[model samples]
Target: MDAQTGSTASAFPPGFPWGGAIAANHAEGAYLTDGKRLDISDGFPRGIKHEYDAVIDPKKCYPTHEAIDFYHRYPEDLALMREMNFRAFRTSINWSRIFPNGDDDEPNEVGLQFYDSLFDEMRSRGMEPVVTLSHYETPIHLVG
Candidate 1:
């Protein structure tokens, strides 16, 4: 409701581009699957609140490690988005997914394929993808 007029807004404008957004480190799991390797986010069990773990702890849970399993379940997830009339989606390319070690001479083929399939799937569903090159999760190999 508008404070001045005490009227409620009808709805968003047509073609307003309803959609969703996700960061790779926050959505995609499979941190070590395919040719992928550890990223800066891999060691942080509690996000940025505490210092990053020197090594991954078996007993500690890292949210990113299995976050919604988006890596393997994107088709299902995208279908849900399509059902909601989504016309756009914002997501990131995991830096380590492409360059597993962050300094590899060549990009990982499997990783490249995954994103290719993901983008293609999004387009197939009539959703325009807005991609972020990275989302602060640098490859762990490059951090140390």
Candidate 2:
């Protein structure tokens, strides 16, 4: 069976929403900077030898210190997406970027600035930006 030979039927109306997906810990790299506190995802051990067991050890973990380095390279990244004629981009914002330390008197300005620029770039490129508040990596302080 081939997808090209499959029957075609209108499952829904046209103009449906379609986009890519990304996660905080898997994308954002500002793990413990700019007032951002460590989250449980940071504590999850990486490179597990067994594929069917659960392991949680902060000491043995390797946090995504520069996962894609999107924080500093978002402009270029957005440009690449624009080249692809993306109608929308789906990404998650780091909770720590907004509420560093989990609870604070106010949100961090530097963190906010990055997002502001990102959104502006997306709009300027004629692409809509879809944001997820917390796909993962909730500040450990929020656990209790």
Candidate 3:
């Protein structure tokens, strides 16, 4: 047995992928704005809903839709993250933002452009981006 039984040494190698996590509905807003359609996340109840129950009307009561407003405020947020020396950012895509109706022949150009700009900003700041295809905000249309 070693003299020092407990140590704070790390087992992982250096530069082992450090980043932050962000959810779609929690970060990006504009849920029903622009060309985006409503998603299941948008329909979630304002305060709390019973288990196995759907949020009938989202527009009226929901905690998100403007949670952090990252959609319209990503530039500032990215800059802040850069200042914090973030090496990477892990965020999910808003299915509704990309495919408003969840089943479309083409993706929304504006939505694509927004993400492009976001990635560019991250790269410009010497940071890597890890994208998650879907977190929790699946388009409501897909439920059917």
Tens digits of per-residue lDDT for model 1, 9-109 = 76789888889999999999898999889998878885458678869889888888898899999999999999999999999999999999999999999
lDDT of 2 by residue, 34-124 (tens): 7667765665546754332123344564545557777778788878887877768878778777787778789988888878888898889
**What total of clashing residue pairs does each candidate reach?**
0, 0, 0
List ranges where model 3 is wrong by over 4 Å.
1-12, 51-59
For model 2, the stretches where C-alpha displacement exceeds 4 angstroms are 1-14, 49-63
Model 1 global lDDT (CA atoms, 0 to 1) = 0.92
Candidate 3: RMSD to truth: 3.2
How close to the true structure is residue 19 of candidate 1, measured as C-alpha lDDT?
A: 98
TM for every model, in the order presented, reads: 0.91, 0.76, 0.83
Question: lDDT of each prediction vs. the true structure?
Answer: 0.92, 0.71, 0.80
Model 2: C-alpha RMSD to truth? 5.0
